[model samples]
Target: MLVREIMTTRVVSVEPSSTVKDAALLMNRHNIGAVPVVDGGSVRGMLTDRDIVLRCVAENRDASTLKVSDICSHGAVTVSPSQNVSEAINLMATEQVRRLPVVDNGRIVGMLSFADIAREKAGMEIAEAISDISMP
Candidate 1:
């Protein structure tokens, strides 16, 4: 199956200039860990819960004071919505990242996660392989 087939269609994104606190609130509200940063319908970066905790909170930086761009992972690894699940899974493993921002025509389309992929199937082998590389 392709990414678009299983990926969440209702994506939640943030702006680069959005504050980390705002992002955090959104994540909390949506019960998500990361959000893609978009500008003019194009992806610029991604802000994960790890980024906020490690880059902002760990450094004594105020979440409300810091912008998503300040701590978001720039030049983020991405996958096309049309790509197959295995390919997306491979990209996540190779990049040592849990989440991938799906882009189409330079715009954010959706987001995929190792967890998302794992949850897509109940195969123990596939889940174990992906879970091994995923960070808590």
Candidate 2:
């Protein structure tokens, strides 16, 4: 199967200049754990709930005052819509990431996540990928 076959198409993104609080609000509203940070039509980074907690909240920095770029993880691993699901899974394991931003022709298109993979019920592959991603 291909990434586009399982990736979530209704993805939400935030600008680098967006406030962490605003990003967090979007996450909350969407019931998602992360959002890709885009700048000038390119992905600059990814902001996750954990980043807000550890980098901003736990650090005692005001979310309203901080930009998503200030706390988001940079150089995020990405996948193309045409890529095979197995290749995408390998990337998730190698990168220790549970989600990947799907880009097409340099444009943010969708998001590939464990939940999407789970729907495939690929069994051992998913288990192994989860184990690798969970490694400390």
Q: Pick the candidate with the highest TM-score.
A: 2
Top candidate when judged by lDDT against the true structure: 2
Each model's lDDT comes to 0.86, 0.88
Off by over 4 Å in 2: 122-136
Per residue, candidate 2 scores C-alpha lDDT tens digits across 47-107 of 9899999999999999998999999999888999999999998999999988899999998
Q: Mind giving the per-residue lDDT tens digits that candidate 1 earns over 96-121? A: 87888888988888888876788777
Model 2, residue 33: what's the lDDT? 81
What C-alpha lDDT, on a 0 to 100 scale, does residue 99 get in candidate 2?
A: 87
Enumerate residue pairs that collide in model 1: none
Q: TM-scores across all candidates?
A: 0.85, 0.88
Where does the lowest 10-residue lDDT sum fall in candidate 1? 127-136
The regions of model 1 sitting more than 4 angstroms off are 123-136
Give lDDT: candidate 2, residue 24.
90
With candidate 2 superimposed using the best TM-score fit, by how many Å does residue 84's alpha carbon deviate from the native?
0.4
